[model samples]
Target chain A: MISLAGRDILHAWGKFVFTGVGLGLLIGVTLTMAGVYRGMVDDAKALLDNSGADLWVVQKDTLGPYAESSSIYDDVYRGILGMPGVERAANVTYLTMQVRRGESDVRAMVVGVVPGGPGEPGQPGYLVAGRRITRGHYEAVADIATGFQLGEQIQIRRNLYTVVGLTRRMVSSSGDPMVFIPLKDAQEAQFLKDNDAIVQQRRRTAENPAFNRPGVPGLLNAAIASQSANPYVNAVLVQIEPGYSPDDVAEPIRRWKRLQVYTREQMEKILVGKLIATSARQIGMFLVILAIVSAAIVAFIIYTLTLGKVREIAVLKLIGTRNRTIAFMILQQAVGLGVIGFVVGKISATFWAPIFPKYVLLEPGDAARGFVAVVVICVLASVLAIRAALKVDPAEAIGG
Target chain B: MLTKGIRINGLKKRYGKGETAVDALKGVDMQVAPGEVVGLIGPSGSGKSTLLKCLGAVIEPTAGQMTLGDEVIYDDGWKISDLRALRRDKIGFVFQAPYLIPFLDVTDNIALLPMLAGHPNNESRQRALELLKALDVAHRARAMPSHLSGGEQQRVAIARALINRPPVILADEPTAPLDSERALAVIRILNQMARQYETAVIVVTHDEKIVPTFRRIYHIRDGRTNEEAGEGRAFE
Candidate 1:
């Protein structure tokens, strides 16, 4: 037999298409929300991947240097390098701040790395443009997401640095782009006080009689010099030898060095499980709400359409159309609407994902799941309309 | 009792129970021979609709005997297990408004009945086309019901009713929406279709224009029926 549902849809295709478009937009927003959550998890993984470290050694009893503030002496890497199973160790510091470029400023994670070539643990892996930061001070390598070009001047605290290289996908766990500068410059930017504070400290030292009274002129100056310099870094990144596992190298630091050490897997758990857990929950709640709203819209639309055809349905019944046949027709129409909406939604989400401020990772697996969910929702939503249609008495077609 | 047409004896229907009980059909006895067209005329609330519903097998009779062709369909209770199949294969119905499935074209609307009864699509369509040609609606075979004029839609409805070639047909006010000319034309088509297909046709109508064209008439009132002979006016 000819498909009753198909013919009806063709007869009023304009109505069906317009309604599907409206529902498609809602589905698009839902898909984008899921992509946003995936993007956050991806950003966390990218941060770990670009760090190029087998282990992270930080201050004891802390979750950072990424999830919390961690401070260790800059000389700590020297002691870590001497430990067994350790191949190379580098001092690294991270401070999230707004760096100035001409007039506008962009938020980024300023990273301090020792001036070294590609093999260093904390250095950017590869450069897309220009060269690495070879100078000891006032030189920077930036992630391209920050929109910085090579040779551009960027102001960090009280000094200016020239952007010497650009990289891609180098972002902090919080999704802020990373800018690498020489270790000393990052130390000063993270720890140094203003010039006025420095002058005031020197004046106070000169007035102190215990140091300057007699025979201690050099001693007073030495005290002022030591007070003005910064020697602290955030964390030390360690790479283990080929034969040594991260656990083997990390255990020695934790046991004898009195420091906290995290292996790659442990650090990933900290970033993804603890750092972004709340955000994932929030997105999940939004998904549930959108699903309910979609089901409600489908049910209301199908019910109204069935009600409009009550007379035709009664006549079909009186003329010996099976109850299941009518029910199946309504169900098929609902699923057809869902299929149209899903295609439109998938395209809309793909088209607009890049324009979103944060990374929106739309996975093919997620799309497949979303399509199944939409079909199931449509089938469930069609039940109400089917029940109403089946209840219509065939005798109603006669003039009673 | 005749075996090749429609016959009923002491047909009855009741609603509710006890003092609140209402009888919609009381001892409705009627019959129409093969190839004959008859009219059933009545005022409002006179058991005409209830009798039609009973004849259409849409409702059960409290007490009655009904026979279509050689089969005993109802004797106090339903003798046939599947009334739906009985309605599909042994009876046809034409309604007041020519209520064709609006989404379907003229051909598919008429073809739907035979297709529902397990005929192949092409064969069902062929049968529908033959009936459409016989009813002089072949030109509008591809037109949707909404695109057809009133008379054309009625002719399509007539074709749908005759597609299954059932032994009996129940038409309820089949020409209610037509002008006098179209009303007479519908009655004339019904008579011609009934004789050509050798089917028994019972048209329930209050239309005065076509009442005299019937050779037999059954007037229903107060849940009962009275049989009489009509003027047998010619409509050529």
Candidate 2:
């Protein structure tokens, strides 16, 4: 038999297509919301991947240095380097701030990396343009997402450093682009006070008799100079020797070194599970609401369409059309509408994803799931219309 | 002799229980022979609709016996387990409003009955084409119901009812929406189709315009029927 539903849709294609487009746009927003959540998780993973660390050693008992503030002495990596199975360790500090470029500024995570050759744990893995940070004090390597060009001088706190290299996908867990500068420069930028505060500190030390007794004249100046320098780093990144498990190296540090150490898996849990959990929940709620709205729209549309055919349906029944046949026609129409909406939604989501400010990672797996969900929703939504159609008495066609 | 058509005996239908009971059909009895067309006339609130519903097998009769061709279809209760199959294979129905499926073309609308009875598409459509030619609607075979005029649509509807060559057809005001001339035309076509297919046709109508066209008619009143002879006027 010819498809009754298909003929009906073709007969009024403009109505079906326009309604599908409207539903498609709503589905697009739902898909984009899921993509946003995936992007957040991807950003967190990218942060860890680019760092090239097997383990992270932070201040004891802290969730940081990504999810929270963490501080340890810059010399902490020296002690971690001597542990068994530890191949390399580097001091790294993260300070999220707005770095100035000409007149405007960009929010970036300024990372302090040891001025070493390639393969340092905290240094950017590879440069896309120019060269890595070769100068110990005044050079910077920035992620291309920061919109910085090669040889551009950017102000980080009081000092100006030339951007010498560019990298891609190097972002902090919060999705801010990373700019790598020499360890000492990042330290000073992180902790240095203005000259006025420094001068006031020196006078305050001099007025104190404990430091400036008449016999010890230089003790006051030495104490004031020590107070002005910063020796703290956010965390130490450690790379274990080949064939050695990170858990092996991290266990001793956690047990003996009086510091918090996390293996790669544990840190991923912290970043994805704890750091972005609330945001994921919020997106999940939006997806649920959009699904319900989509179901409601499909149900209402199908019900109205069926009601319009009451006379025809009664005749069909009187002339011996099966209940299953009538039910199937309505079902096929609903699923057809869902298929149209899905195609439009997928295209719209792909087109608009890049325009979003944050990363929107649209995974193929998620899309497949979304398509199945839409079909199921359409089938469920068609129930109301099918019931209404089936209840139409064939006797009504005879006209009482 | 009992002919190859429809035979009804003591057909009854009641709505609700004691104290509020309403008998819609009070022992309706009628017969229409093959190759003959008959009219059933009644006033409002008469048993016309209830009897039609009973003949169509759309509703169960409280007590009755009905025979189509050689088969006993109803006796106090349904003798056939599948009333839907009975309606599809042994009975045909035509409504006041043509009610051709709007989405379907003229050909498919007529062919749908045979298709529903498991005929292949090509065969069903072939049968429909033959009937459409007989009904003089072969030119508009591809036209949708909306594009057809009222007279054309009713003709197509008659063609649909005759497609399966069922033993009996129940027509409920087949020409109510047409003018007197068109109404006469419909009656003429129904009479021709009934004779050509050797099918029994019972037309339920209140239109005086085409009532005289029937040679015999059954007038229903107060849930009962009385047989009468019609003018048998020719359609000119």
TM-score per candidate, chains pooled: 0.96, 0.97
Candidate 1, DockQ score (0 to 1): 0.76
What is the docking quality class of candidate 2?
Answer: medium
Cα lDDT for residue A274, model 2? 92
lDDT of 2 by residue, B130-193 (tens): 9999989999999999999999999999999999999999999988999999999999999999
Chain A TM-scores, one per candidate? 0.94, 0.96
Once model 2 is optimally superposed onto the true structure by TM-score, how far is the C-alpha of residue A167 displaced, in angstroms?
A: 1.1
Candidate 1 lDDT over residue span B105-172, tens digit each: 99999999888888998999999999989999899999999999999999998889888999999999
RMSD (CA, Å), candidate 2 to true, equals 1.7
DockQ for each model: 0.76, 0.77
Q: Candidate 2 chain A, which ten residues in sequence have the lowest lDDT sum?
A: A216-225
Worst 10 residues of 1 chain B by lDDT: B227-236
- For each predicted model, how many residue pairs clash, with residues at least 3 apart or on different chains? 0, 0
lDDT of 2 by residue, A1-400 (tens): 7788999999989999999999999889989999999999999999999999999999998998898889999888888999999999999999999999999999999999998877889999888998888778999999999999999999999999999999999988778999999998998989888989888888898898988889876898788878988999999999999988988889998888899998889999999999999988989999999999999999999999999999889988989999999999999999999999999999999999999878899999999999999999999999999999999998888887
